[model samples]
Target: MKYFAVFFFVFISNVFFAQEKENGTLVNGIIKDDTTGNLLSGVNIINVNTVKGAISDDKGVFHLQAFANDTLHISLLGYKSIKVKVTNDWIKNKTTTIQLTQKAYALEEVVIRPYVLTGYLEIDAKLIPTRENYRYSISGLKEGYEAGEYSPNAFGRVLGSIFNPADMLYNFFGKKPKELRRLKEMKKDDTVKNLLASKFDRETISALLGVSKSEIAEIMERCNYSESFVKTANDLQIMDAISACYEEYKILKR
Candidate 1:
């Protein structure tokens, strides 16, 4: 009974130690350019044979967690690759500083002619008009050119058709004759004509027209229109467009 108890105690201790070993560890490090000593961001650090990895942040700091026995590989776009072994001591003391040496490249010096036309000299630069252009144009006319009595449902349906070509085709040719007839009747409504005549806010109009915001602003002011309409325009994702529109609108408003 005494010998059996000793064996069971040893077995339990072994299992605990095994579990502790499997828990692994984490190592934090920074990547820097060797030549300039500048911090390098987006350095790729991975295990040598395994798929585990982490990318350095904008501050060149990175933290990687893995088994203490695992090997690590580090690489940067313009730097030489490095492989390092993660030892038990290294795991216990977490932080590390990794400096990646930049790879030197040899370039054969050659002078090339400036007027080397490789392909077609005159490429077609004309913008190809898609169905989106037409839909937006109609939308612009309805929203900007005429704002009063805007049919949100009709406009939404037309916009939806531009996105869903299959749905548009189904609606045009499908067996729902009653729905098609109703849509035709709605299209010919007199209110639609009145709605199209209301002046749209310059910014909103420009967005719908897919014109430069500034350009539309200028057009509106020059035409003696109110900048008050600008409030209807949403925050645009395109920075350049927004900037240009704001600049032009300022000048035109002046």
Candidate 2:
């Protein structure tokens, strides 16, 4: 009887351990194309709440750290973006399959302008119009530069941002405290950084930051980021800009 009791206790402990391991923190998933039923690879999977990111392999499989109530943003180049909310059932099940529908792209009309440039350097320069811009620096900030056009009110706007950093970034980072808090987590993930570094589009950043593209531009502008950087920088650069600006704002608040 003693031997039997010991065996039963050991068996129960093993069962409990197995159950715990089965319901782990990682969510395993396979992605496929809805129309063709073909496995899709290179899909971007991001846990927006945690700011953890992963990419689907050639086998169309991906694993990401997620939990109940957290949301996952899945996207690819040609497919429609999807948001999957993690549920208690999903946590228990531990595996899922997602299908993405292809996005219908409509081509817009394009007008091609023929540029007639003479062989002279001065004449070619005259053919292209250039806008003059200026950068202003504010004291007591780290790497702060206000970019503005060569206009009458440009200096005043830059001065306003320099003097009142909080007001400039309040609309961008104030209301989205939960999302902004994940900035550090985002910077820690090498996969997320690589994904952002290669992409020019702000889609992933927008989803992670919970802001629109226009809002992102506006926020960066108010934070004294140069217009050239705001318009031309990669997603990783934009992420760094937001992180720096938010850190400055936090320090200023204290």
Candidate 3:
């Protein structure tokens, strides 16, 4: 009788553990931008009161296991974060799409002034003393972009590439007149941001902007630049933009 009772208890424990491991309680979802309806990759999702968490992949999909009453917190840069209560009913339904709204920058009471590089330098000299480090960082970022490394931050990478001063001059004077013209059209017509948003990563952006990276990839997709003039010009513009940002940072610091 004693042996039989012990055997029964062991069997029940095994069944309970198995059910916990392979139960109907699973949370799966996708994160996307509310305005554009584009999937947002690299968004972080965490359980608010627990250490459990996951990150959205390239396809913006995430899967996590939870019990009936767990709360999930979702966050991404440039967008407002959201918290959702997970119940048994929620888990049973599965397959959720969480929409994140974009946060608008408040422009009220803010003064708009023309961007003057020299004036920026004079002000920076008082603020940040480590100006040389900033320059070195930007220079390194330019080099990484030219070498075809993807940035980690999407916004930072696009800004770094588009605002590079050396690249602008090179395109103006280089051989690929047609390509340079296309770039100009993209810039003037305001399509550059969209193009980069669709393609760049945070690491790629950080590399382009002289910021730190959480993860780095060994390879990046090469830009389609067949014309020598276009290629040279684009490269120069990217490098120059990074330099310019660094220069401004130095000036502000001083």
Angstrom error at residue 115, model 1 = 21
lDDT of 1 at 103: 78
CA lDDT for candidate 2:
0.77
lDDT winner: 2
Off by over 4 Å in 2: 1-24, 114-127, 131-168
TM-score of each: 0.35, 0.74, 0.36
RMSD of each candidate? 22.1, 6.3, 18.7
Q: Candidate 2 on 1-254: residue-level lDDT in tens?
A: 99999999999999977765554378789999998989999999888887788999998999987768888999898999999998888778988889999999999999999889898998999998675555534322356344443346634544455456466465566678888888778878887877887777898889998888888888877666667767767787777767766776666555
lDDT of 1 by residue, 95-204 (tens): 77778898789999899855544466353323332221111112222343311113334334334433454653223323333322332232243332222223232322
TM-score pick, better of 1 and 3: 3
- Residue 129 deviation, candidate 3, in Å? 15
